[model samples]
Target: MTGLLVKNYGIKKAAKLSGVSEYTLRAWERRYSIIIPFRSESNRRLYSEYDINKLKLLRKLTERGIQISNLSSLSINDLKGLLNRVDSEIISTDEKYLQLYDIASVDKTINDSLEAIKNFNEKKLLLILHRAYKKSNFLEFVENVLFPVMVKIGYQWKSGLLRIAHEHFTSAVIVKFVLKISSEFEIKNKAPKIVITSPDGQHHDFGAIIGDSLAASEGWKSTYLGVSLSAEDIATAVNQTNSHCIFLSIIYPNDNPRMEAQLLELSKSIHDDVVIIAGGNAVTGYKDILTNINAHIVKTPKHFRDTLKSIRNQIRIDKRENYEKKYL
Candidate 1:
C-alpha cells in the first residue's frame, strides 16, 4: 500500500470510528459527494483522516437538527464553530430541535411511503425507504421509520385505503430490505445469539424483521426465522443456535385458541436460561400466558430496546457469577 493509503482507513473502519452505518457512509460519498474517498488498487473505499473527522462533525450536526445537505462544503473550523455554538446553546435547545425534527422527518417519510404504496409505485416506495435509511440513524430508521410505516400500512389496509396487494408489496420490499441490511451490521466477538420469529398461525413478519435488525445493531448475533413456525420448530432452532434470547412477534388473530398452548409449549421447550421477549399489536391478547411463562412483554419500540438491554445485562451478570464460581 502507498504511504498515503496506509494512513487512511477502510470503509468498515471508518464507519466504526465515525458511528455511521456502511450504507449511509457510501450514500454520503456517492449521493452528496461530501467526502469522496480514495480507491485502493483493489477498488476498496479508503477514507483519509480528514474524511473521518468531517463525518464525525457532520453526524453531530445532523443529530442537533442541522441538515446534512447543507454541511458538505463547510470547513473543519466552521464545523467546530457550529458545534461550539450548539454546546453554548446558541443553536436551538437540543431536545426541542431533535423532537421536532424527528417527528416531522419520520412523519413525512411514513406519509410518502404510504402514498407510494397507494399508487402501486414500487420504485417510489423503494426510493423513500432508501432515503430514510440514509438520513436516519439505526434506531430512527428501524423504529421510527420502518415500524410506523408497517403499522400505518396495516391500518390503512384494514380501513380499505389500501388493498391486500399493496400490503403484500410493501411487506415483500421490507423483507428484502431487512434481509439486505441485516448482513451489513458488524457483530461483536462472542456476542449473544437471539432467535427472532412469530408463532405458528401468525404470518406477520415485520415485527420479527425489526426485532432481528435492531438486535444486530445492539451487537447480538440474530437469526430471524421467517414467520409462522411452530413452537417445536422455534425451540429446536433456538437450541441449535445456542441462543441467549427468543423474540416472538405476535401481530394478529388476537383470539387464536392455539396461541396459548403454543406459548406454553415454547416456554417448556427452550433452554431454561434463555430469555423470552414478546411484542407486537396482538401481544396483549396473550399477556396472561406470556406473564405465566415469565416472558418480557415490550409494548413499544423503546420498550423493546430497553428490554434487550435489561436481558443483556442479566446475561452478563450470570456469566460473571458463573465465572467467579468456577475460577475465582
Candidate 2:
C-alpha cells in the first residue's frame, strides 16, 4: 500500500514517529540499507510514509529481541507476519524457561484471583496469592502472577467491567501482602540502600511496592516510600537514609503537566551520585526530563536486575579502594 506517498519527513521527524534513534536509523541506512529514503536537493535524507512504517516495525521487532541483521533482508510483509503470529510466536528461551512457570497453572491462578476480586472475596484472594507466593520465587511470582493479575484488574476497572471499589480492594490486599512478604527478608549490613516510590501526582504505588520487593531480592535494602510524595520530601528521605539509589515507578497519569517540574525538582535535590532508576507505563511522557536527570530507564525486570548488580559491584569497588588507600 502506498502510505502517505505525497508526504515526506526529515530524519528527526522519522525518528520521533518511528521510536528509533536517529543514529541507529542512519547506521541502518548506511550499513544495512534497510530503507533508502529520498534524498533532498540539499542531500538531507527524507523518509516517506512507507519508510516510517518500516522503521516502526523494525523497532518493535528489535525490542522483542529479534536481531536487526536477521531482519534486514526481510520484506515489510515478512516483518508483519512475524509480529502477527500472536498465538504461536516463538520465544527465545530454552525449555527450562517453559518449565519455570507452568503457563496453564499460572493462568488458572490469575483467573482465580480475578474472580475473587470480582466477588470481593478477601479470604479466597489472599489464599490464592499466598499459594502462588509459596510456589514461586520473588521474580517469578511478580512477573507471572502478581503483575499479570494486577494488569488485568486495571484494564477491567478502566473498561468499567468492575467497580472502583474492587480495584481499591485488590490494591489494599496486595500492598499489605507484598510489604509483609518483603519485610521477612533481613537486610544485610553491606546491602546497598534504595528508596522506592512514585512521585507526587502519581497515585499508583503497586509499582513502587514491587520495586521494593525486587530490590530486596537483589540484596538492596529498599525502603518502600509508598506513592505520591513530593520531590522535596523524597530528596530529604534519600539524604536522611543515605540511599545509594532512588527508584521511581511512574505507572499512571501518563500526561501530567507537573511531571517535568516534579522530576526536575527531584534531580536538583538529590546528590549526583544517587542513581535514579525509572520504569513503568508513564515514564515515556517525561522522557526529556528523565534524560536531563541522567536517570537510567530500565525496560524489563531483567534489565533492572542487571543495573542493580552493576551498582552493587561499583559500591564494593569503592569500598575496596578506600581500604587500600588507608593502609597502602
- Poorest lDDT segment (10 consecutive residues) of candidate 1: 90-99
TM-score of predicted model 1? 0.66
What tens-digit string does per-residue lDDT give for candidate 2 at 1-328?
5766544899877865665656678778888999888888999889988888788778767655578898999898998888667215543222323333345345789889989999999889999999999998888887777766766776678889998999899988998888888888777997899999999998888888888888988889887778999999999999999998999998888898988998888887976567788988777777777755657666556657777886676677657766877998
Q: What TM-score against the true fold does each predicted structure earn? A: 0.66, 0.67
lDDT of 2 at 229: 93
Clashes of 1: 0
Off by over 4 Å in 1: 1-106
Off by over 4 Å in 2: 1-106
After TM-score superposition, the amount by which residue 29's alpha carbon in candidate 2 deviates from its true location, in angstroms, is: 31
